[model samples]
Target: MKSNRRQFIKISTLGTGGLALGLSSMNLNGINAAYAANKNEAVSDEDLTPYPTYCEVCFWKCAAWTYVDKKGEIRKIIGNKEDPHCNGRLCPRGTGGIGMYHDEDRLKNPLIRETKEDGTQYYRDASWEEALDLIADKMGKIKKEHGPECVALFSHGTGGKLMGHLLKAYGSSNISAPSFAQCRGPREVAFTATFGEDVQSPERTDIRDTKCLVLIGSHIGENMHNGQIQEMSDAIDNGATI
Candidate 1:
């Protein structure tokens, strides 16, 4: 009986080890199958032509130099010193913005989800024309049922202006944005209460000429508002207090 138990334990251990080995081998085979071709393709600066453009990562639109290889692969993005927003510097978000274009999993086409008879949903890629036509038909049906004001938009930053325009044209006064409510709302209220009007976006704080600055909760450098931080640096250089 002891001999039989020992044999059983040995067999169980060997079976577990064999299963792990098989799984590892299958994973390696799957990886090899997925990357059968060379996966180390790269573009160098020497093979790229640099073109000046503006970043859309944030509302700032920092001027940037984009380097595109002959095959139209973007190799890099750098700040253009001429642009005041960047002052020749880019934040981490701006520097990493290239991923938006080069990401392998980024959506390239519109998708329409079709509900299967069994309650499963499957999405199919669609052309721009087809997607737009479907949206228009649905929107028309909605407007007929309710009203144009039923549509509301919550947008962000400068890129959102086009959508705002479209919504307003479609008779949507119900638009709202939390970006305004949270990020800039307090500043607007403060300025309006004190000065009878609020300053434009960016607040245009003359940090370079200020004698003293008091920070409440704002981590200026860490907030990544490039222009303000640059001006704050200049103010620090000119011997301004915290």
Candidate 2:
């Protein structure tokens, strides 16, 4: 009985060891296969022309280089080392920004909503000129009915600045940027109530120099604030406590 028990234990141990070895071998082979496949698809720098650009995926606006092939196809986006936002690393969204151009399901044209005789609504593609003309006609009718000041424009970004100018010239003082409200509205209000001034975007938090970081409800790493995440990493390296 004792000899049988010893044999059983040895066999079990050997079987487990063998299974682990087999799995490791399989994993190594899989990794080699992936490496070979990637090597075959590798593009040389000479084949790509890099253009300086900033990611529009999120508000971080991480500067990056858009590498295009000889055929003007956007191949990849690499973070610009000099950029203060990301340094030399782009977030997953920014890295995958090229996928936006390649996605077949992306909206490529303006669509106008039309109703069927039975009252079901569907959208039909329309030319850019037709869309612009329709918008202008609607705006004209609205201006005729109500004063231009009644036409409120909720907008954001650089294009929004141009639209704000157009609305201002049209005599509307009701232009508001929704981004400011969405991103920092509550924080702005709180800061104003407490400190008399709110911290602006591209906030100047000296995270790297801080010894202790207290996050009340902030999701710094998960929020994809590239600069803040990088600085937080440095702070952690320098013995900062969160």
Quote model 1's TM-score.
0.69
Candidate 2 clashes: the total is 0
As a whole number from 0 to 100, the lDDT of residue 98 in candidate 1 is 56
- For model 1, the superposed segments whose C-alpha errors exceed 4 Å read 1-47, 185-203, 208-211, 233-241
- Find the candidate with the highest lDDT and give its number: 2
User: What would the per-residue lDDT of candidate 2 be over residues 34-116, giving only the tens digit for each residue?
Assistant: 34433445588898899999988777898999888776667678899998888889876677566555544447999899999
Give lDDT: candidate 1, residue 99: 51
Residue 174 miss distance in model 1 (angstroms): 1.9
lDDT of 2: 0.74
Tens digits of per-residue lDDT, candidate 1, 101-182, equal 6544457999999999999999999999999999989988888899999998988888578888888887778778888888
What lDDT score is found at residue 91 in candidate 1?
64
Q: Residue 8 in model 1: shift from native, Å?
A: 63
- In model 2, where is the ten-residue run with the lowest total lDDT? 1-10
Best by TM-score: 2
